[model samples]
Target: MLKRYKKYSFLFQELVHRDFTKKYKRTALGIGWSVLSPLLQLLVMKIMLTKFFATGIEHYTTFLFAGNIVFNYYNESTSSGMTALAENSAIISKVNVPKYMFVFSKNISSLISFLLTVVVFFVLAALDGIEFTWKITMLIFPIVCLVLFNIGLGLVLSACYTFFRDLQYLYSIFTFLLMYMSAVFYDISAYSDFAQKLFLLNPIYLFIRYFRKIVMEQTIPTIWFHLLMILDVCIVMIGGFYMYKKYNHDFLYYF
Candidate 1:
């Protein structure tokens, strides 16, 4: 994979630049939306749900920001990635380039937005009185995990999307359900032990939990937790790569 990217590094750079810049092409704030959009969401969620979910919860705004930012990045990357092939069908059909390149480029763009929001997240955390400690650096684990996971899922979604356009709409609904289940604006600590275990089954929720543990609880999760996170990435990565290999040729026909 590194070799492929190296061979096509020029195209990769162009794709990354185009993907990132095209998003805010005509907007006044341009790249500022990357931070403002998520911050606005955090304000609305905090104002609307604070009475119900924020009660007795410390640093509620930061907690909500953590979940919101993670899920937004997941949704944005995968959703844009799903159409990476179809949207660039003209270039994809004629240009001798990699299909995964589109996926990687789209995701890298969304990741740029996510990182911008994370800068604001830290500021909000400080204002909310959350103490920063050495463990906070550990969030690099889940951020990296989600990046790989999004790419893997992007590969699978883009492959499917070439054949079935309806997948785009269906995936939006799936992400909506995923957002609610991710406990973005609510507290899942109120659930039973068994129920809490069930939340771990959700890959999106797992990352959110990791954020809360590090930023809110000021502790690192166990090694088993790390293993489980990697397990989720592995399952998706293996499955996505398998589909791409199997459908590599078929993708051309769909175009």
Candidate 2:
């Protein structure tokens, strides 16, 4: 096998191109669907929940957009990453490319789409009369958190799905549940203090809350928030890398 960490740099361009082409192939409207899907969901959710949440949040649609962008990124990364390797079995058997490349490629694809959705969210937020402030720069930190967490998650899920084919379906259900549990559609602080503490333990909620604070509320993320995210990302990435490396060779047999 190629040396660990070497393959990411060597095969980066090829994997990115392959991932981009494969994603939009045979699809009508092509990449437009990426922007449309999240926007459509945001519209529907906003219309339905507006009456209930209208009291606290003046612009419910923008609130939904802020939260949905972060949630969609997490869901897409985890779901696609889980099946990335298994779906690329033909290439795996024929070439000597690193297995992690396939998983990383899927994540890159999802991140591209996520970035597109973020642009759309910003446009809608602007339309809603949300002013751009310097605090908007806080978005950069959460984006870095997203990348760090996703790379680690993609590695671990790709490795796990190699041994358990059923995991793909199970992961989908789990992701949906996680989405609701997160502060995606509603603010968790609205809950009791004990419930809020429990929710903060969820990394997904932490990512969303931080982004919403910066993008929608125009507030800077706290130092403690950045520190906690960094710690979480490091633990996940190191542990995931070790697991993926140990199981790298065995993945082909399952595929």
Number of the top TM-score candidate = 1
TM-score of each: 0.98, 0.92
Candidate 1 lDDT by residue in tens digits, 1-255: 889889999998899999999999999999999988998888898889998888878888888999999999999999999999999889988987888899999999999999989989999999999889999899999999999999999999999999999999999999999899988888887899999889889999999989999998999999999999999999888988999889987887888
lDDT of 1: 0.92
Once fitted onto the true fold, the runs of candidate 2 whose alpha carbons sit more than 4 angstroms away are 1-10
lDDT of 2 by residue, 112-194 (tens): 99989888888998899888898887788889888879989888888888898888889889988998888677766578899
- For model 1, where is the 10-residue window of minimal lDDT? 91-100
Query: How good is model 2 by TM-score?
Result: 0.92
* Candidate 1 runs further than 4 Å off: none
lDDT of 1 at 238: 93
Q: In model 2, which residue pairs have backbone atoms overlapping below 3 Å? A: none
